[model samples]
Target: MVALDGPSGTGKTTVARKLADRLSAGYLDTGAMYRMVTLAVLRAGIDPADAAAVAGLADGVDLEIGTSPQRPGFRLGGEDVSAEIRGPEVTKAVSPVSAVPHVRELLVARQRRIIAEVLGEVGGIVVEGRDIGTVVVPDSPLKVFLTASADVRAARRSSQDTAAGRQSTVADARESVERRDRLDSSRTASPLRAAEDAVPVDTSELSIDQVIVALCELASHRGLLAGCSAEAAR
Candidate 1:
């Protein structure tokens, strides 16, 4: 398994999907699991700041996540909620839900099981999340901590909102990213941090293709690729 750990707006999701495609491996976005839980909490009218309530709700919610990079689907309570989980309310609530110790424990176990399934079926998998390397898969042979400057990340988020026909200023985006960073990094349970053995990749000045090429090269150097020529050349 390839563990890609990073904070929000760092392109972890996009980079992980492309890397999985290049390696012909399955992709797991653990963050989506947390987001699904957040959506469920909102629907149930639970207070996001109430750790006990959120943890209790998360314990019973049924979550299904697709490993295929080309068709990643997220379901909560047997309902397809891939798009719903990405809405503003869910995004706002995910940090608190993720902060709950029991919630993280529950989701981390589920993530590991999903990883095993992907490994058995595809022979390899790339998993991305805030704590994947540190807590979820610390033994992963290849651990990458993708990072970028706050300004760059905020700008990217603004661009994304614009593309989606939402008006978001860079200033607001920056504040949001910073606030999330503080919450995630300070959380007591499985905080956002790079593992000791992880290789930090700064993507502040890199393009999507550049980051992918670099990651492929790193994977090749670590002898994780079946054939570097065929995989990296793509």
Candidate 2:
């Protein structure tokens, strides 16, 4: 398994997908899973701070996340909710829902099981999230912690929202990103910290392709891929 841990707007999801494709491995966006749980909590009219209630909801819901990079499906209770989980509502609610201790415990277990299943069936899997390296998969041989300047991340996020017609300003995006960083890092449950052995990549000045190449090199250096370093050089 490969663990890619990073905060929002750092291109964790995109990079994880590309890495999976490059390595011919399965991909899992743990963030999307959290978003789906947040969506369920909101739809059920449960308070975001109600940890016990949210945990119960998370435990009760059945999530099926696809590992295909080209067709990653996020389903909740057997319903396809890929688009719904990425909307503004779930975006705002996910931090608190993910902060809940029991919720993380339940989802982390599910994530581990999925990783094991994918490893058995597909040989490898790349899983991305804030706490994947530190909490979910500490033993993953290749753990990457991606980072970018706050300004760069905010601009990137604003551009994404613009493309999606979300009407977000750069200033607002910066605030949201900062807020999420604070919440994710301060949360008592599996807080967002890079594992001690994780390779850190500062992506503030790099393009998505460049970051992917760096990660590919790291994997190659660690002997995860036989010729990934040469492929990255090319």
lDDT of each: 0.89, 0.89
Residue-wise C-alpha lDDT for candidate 2, range 1-234, written one tens digit per residue: 789998899999888898888778899999998998999999999998898899888878888899898788998989999988988888888999999988888889999998999999989999999988888888899999999999999999999899988899999999999999999999988888889999899989998788888888788778897676566556
Clashing residue pairs, backbone N/CA/C < 3 A, model 1:
none
After TM-score superposition, what is the CA distance of residue 234 in candidate 2 from its true location, in Å? 5.4
Evaluate model 1: give its lDDT.
0.89
TM-score of 2: 0.97
Predicted candidate 1 versus true structure: per-residue lDDT over 35-55, tens digit per residue: 999998999999999999998
- Report residue 226 deviation for candidate 2 (angstroms): 1.3
List TM-score per model, in order. 0.97, 0.97
Q: Which ten residues in a row are the worst by lDDT in model 2?
A: 225-234
RMSD of 1: 1.2
Residue pairs clashing in model 2 are: none
Task: List where candidate 1 sits over 4 angstroms from the true fold.
Answer: 228-230
